[model samples]
Target: MTLPGLLSATVAEAIELVGDVRAVRRTLETLVDLGLGYLTLGEDTPALSGGEAQRLKLAGQMGRTQRDAVFVFDEPSVGLHPLDVRTLVHVLDRLVDNGATVLVIEHDLDLIANADWVIDMGPGGGAAGGRLVARGTPEQIAADDDSLTGGHLRRHLGG
Candidate 1:
């Protein structure tokens, strides 16, 4: 359903409306995975948190034929619980498995650690710096003593 179509129903209500259809039930499962089982589809779109919006978009892509596509996300882990973040990771993994290339601009350590490669920018944020401080696999970044990301990653990696 479109946003206007959903304006009167909670997601749970939408699921009930469909009555035992596998696809609708899977959507509720996706919402729960994203820590959004409590959402009313009637809620204003602009009121959603960043993580909520990102996950909603992901939900839309569910079961689609995806290949040769590039998906970009900015700070998708924001406002997500660690467990929810794990769910988000699985979604991204599925995208890759379906042959999409995913690029995420993020600062969350778990997300960063899970990346196959990383480009860490800055000696400082904004005008204070624009240099590429490091670029490597997460383990390589963690080994760079001068990178701030390295320090946090080191701790996260327990190294």
Candidate 2:
């Protein structure tokens, strides 16, 4: 139904399923605390600022105990201020460290620079694009002449 309602229901179900109300309550409290700064859980689909929504979704996924699923995120940094972007990056890194393959489609160079593996699609943005222009560590991408991503990345790094 509504966002808050959905979140509440999901949280309740999770608590019941896990049979650990204390742990679930603690986790929910942590999420709410985090949300207090950037999100407003509304009656229907919380009126989340872009970054808050992204972070909340990510937190929910990270809270899962599953270890072998492929997680895909599209522009996870869409509305974050630079500071929040850094926080989001750290969260992603933690997820990777915990044994998950994260595939993210993003245009934020800073975040891309920290990725373990980056697959850049280009030559151009639309009908003129769709091929892999570069794929490597941030350094390799920065040094490659064939990649548009390299130029922007190099500039950002002042290389």
Candidate 3:
């Protein structure tokens, strides 16, 4: 016997049915981070965008207790606002502090600036790229004339 209606309830509706208020609240926060706050549990998983799916996976990983792990992310800031980027950075920073190695492939200067280390790639993209242009802290990257990323970072930082 199955309660199809109950099983198909929206996230908001299902949260109402959960006994643990804190857990529901935490789940809501995670959903918000994934930009899925507007979604209902009734929404099919296949309807999610690639970024949404990635974030959902990241959210699940965030709850795990993993040490000495390597986490890689691609453009996590793709759909996030500046404030949301800050939140995402905070989470990544926490993971790093907790002994996880986070390697993010991003073009967002804000995220780059907050990183402990950066490996700037490419003298150019596509057929002209795959070279390591620079590697250092944000300050060093910003000062490296060989790095296009550094030029942009320098401008962004008003250096």
> In order, what is each prediction's RMSD in angstroms?
3.3, 6.3, 3.4
> Using Cα atoms with residue i matched to residue i, what is each candidate's TM-score against the true structure?
0.85, 0.74, 0.81
Q: Candidate 1 — which residues are off by over 4 angstroms?
A: 1-18
Q: Which scores better on TM-score, 1 or 3? A: 1
**For residues 12-98, could you state the per-residue lDDT of candidate 2 as single tens digits?**
343334455686666655454333233323324466555556666666675675478777877877777777677677767777888
Evaluate model 1: give its lDDT. Answer: 0.84
Model 3 regions more than 4 Å off: 1-20, 33-38
Q: How would you encode candidate 3's per-residue C-alpha lDDT over 1-159 as one tens digit per residue?
A: 135774576555665565477976678667665555556666777987665667777877766775988988888787777787787788788788888999999999999999899999899899888989999999999999999999999998999
Best-fitting candidate, scored by TM-score: 1
Order of the predicted models by TM-score, top scorer first: 1, 3, 2
1 or 3, which is superior by lDDT? 1
Check candidate 2 and list the clashing pairs: 3-45
The ten-residue window of minimal lDDT in model 1 covers 1-10
Deviation (Å) of 94 in candidate 1: 1.2
Question: How much does candidate 1 score in TM-score?
Answer: 0.85
